[model samples]
Target: MIKRKFFMTFIVFFFLFPLQIAAETIEEPDVSSEAAILMDAKSGQVIYGKNEFVRMNPASITKIATAIYAIENGVLSDQVVVSEQATKVEGTTVYLEPGEIVSLEKLIIGMVVNSGNDAAIAIAEHIDGSLTNFEKNFNVYLQDYIGVSSTHFENPHGLYGENHYTTAYDMARITQHAMENEIFRSIFKIQEYEWDGESWDTTIVNHHRLVLGEFPYDAEITGGKNGFVSQSGFTLVTTATKGDLDLIAVTMKTNLKNEPYAETLSLFDYGFNNFKTEVIPKGSKFTVDNEEFVAEDDLIYTVNIHDKVSNKINPSGVLSIYNGENEQIASFNLKSLSAPVTKNITDENEENWQANGFLGTMELAILGVSAIIVVLVIQKLRKRA
Candidate 1:
């Protein structure tokens, strides 16, 4: 009985030890938002997520997508003729009058810096000729080019449209894609912009509290957008950099205005404390069964700061990365430096070759010897004749 009790205790300890170690390696942050995600901007890896895939209203953060799309598709110097419908857009505005001619560049500044619904409409109409066409084309662009599937925008500005919904993960991805554009990055990080519009002429400050240093946070606040509506609660998208890590945090559907900001700070802390990004430099070579493969471009990935990471490369030039817990965290397709050798053999023959092993080698040796003997016999017979 004593031995049996000791054995059971040992089994329990053995089973539970690994679970405890894994839990201690990386700690999750306490977040109040309904949907939130923390992503490595460089690698596009989600270090932490909570209900990130659940669709929710994005509010005015939709401007990030709109600004990037317009910058890429439209000429900045083109003068846009504001329509009556654009002037009538509700929510925030640059106070454009009907028949006002605004440069596309200035409109983008107003829309991004001031969160102007009027400028959003004007830019949308200028790019696509109508709000309806802008909505359709913009959704397609988000899905196809930005590679976000769970996002759909009914308006260029995020209003209370029933169909204007996006997931936290999708918002993070959209922000990541937008931050890659130099023009978008410059505009996104602006703390204040001088507005010289037809109806309004004043300095427009960024609405994000952290970007303006309204909140106490340690990391460098790079860029951010904030939004609110009756249906969507408070939504925030923030990008920050600390050390070698660049992070994007998105929080949506918080009841209190300060809740999303607090949660964003919590997420940034979690990412900066527990995770890190590493790059496999371009032209890095990997070997699989004597075949060589190379990373055609720089491959970036994130991992828990306290965990060991291992990489596995297959013959097809696919690299899979795993953390200490043996969980696969990321994967990349590599360029083949050399073609893998192919063997033409049936399953039965392959199985026989494996199973016979030394016996198969012995058989080949015997056959070779027999052939040699036959040749020698023929030569001796010819000489005798």
Candidate 2:
């Protein structure tokens, strides 16, 4: 009877413990977005994802790429005169009038903060000469600069069209790239930018609920952009920081009005609570066998906080990191150091040049042997002569 009880207890332990362990692993939030992603802003790693690669209409979020492009390529102090085409653009506007002069800085602020399609058009025309040229160049611009594959832009402002589309994954990557630029990041996350331009005079407030702190959400929301079209549904993108963890979340085609915001919070919670960014400081060193290695730059890797993260220098000098389950997470090339390794070598390791190189010694020994052999042969020839 005791044996039977012991057997039952063992079986229960074997089954229940593994199940509990599995449950303790990362659990994704129940998000209602049609497509979404939560990405590490620093490392460009997607921490949480759903239908991320499928292309959909980006709507006015196209302004993000446009805004950054303008900041990077144009002179902010230069004054731009609005064109008639800019005034007639459909959807949202800053009510820009033809021949009204505004600094490139104010126009960018108005476009991003206000979602003013007119500002986007004026900026595009001013920089690229025409909408056709702007669209053509900006497509190349996004592909080349932002490093996105599934995004294509047909307009400067994200007006819905058959060809104007981007994936949630691509949008997140684009946002990540944009956030790296100080000029773009500054314009993107402003709370309420007061604008007193030539023709348009009003406070350009960010429409994103999270950015404005309109509700009980993250006050850490540095900035965000939102868009809606009958065709595209609610498309939202936001960036937030808590301690060392900075994250980007993109949601698309949600039925509910606040579902995207809810999903954004959930994803941020999942990321910040579960994951951590570990910085392997620049110039950190390791010894692989008898050779030394150094990290070229500060290495940033994000992993689940519960995971046991460790790095190992392989025989080939590549640094590989493993997570809690002993799964490899990331690998980077280590700059080999000419300095000898910490591990000492003995006579047994003499022939193993990899452990402690003796190439110079080998070359000297060869020369000595050849010299002796040559002298010995010369003496033999003299004796024969």
In terms of TM-score, the best-performing candidate is 1
lDDT per residue (tens digit) for residues 20-128 in model 2: 3543676899988789999998877779889999889978888888988898889999999999989999999998888899899988988889999999999999999
Model 1 alpha-carbon miss at residue 107, Å? 0.9
Per-prediction TM-score: 0.83, 0.81
In candidate 2, what residue range of length 10 has the lowest lDDT sum? 14-23
lDDT of 1: 0.91
Tell how far residue 87 is off in model 2, in angstroms.
0.8
Candidate lDDT scores, in order, read 0.91, 0.86
Each candidate's number of clashing pairs is: 0, 0
Error of 2 at 221 (Å): 0.7
Find the 10 residues in a row with the least total lDDT in model 1: 16-25
Residue pairs in candidate 1 whose N, alpha carbon or C atoms collide under 3 angstroms: none
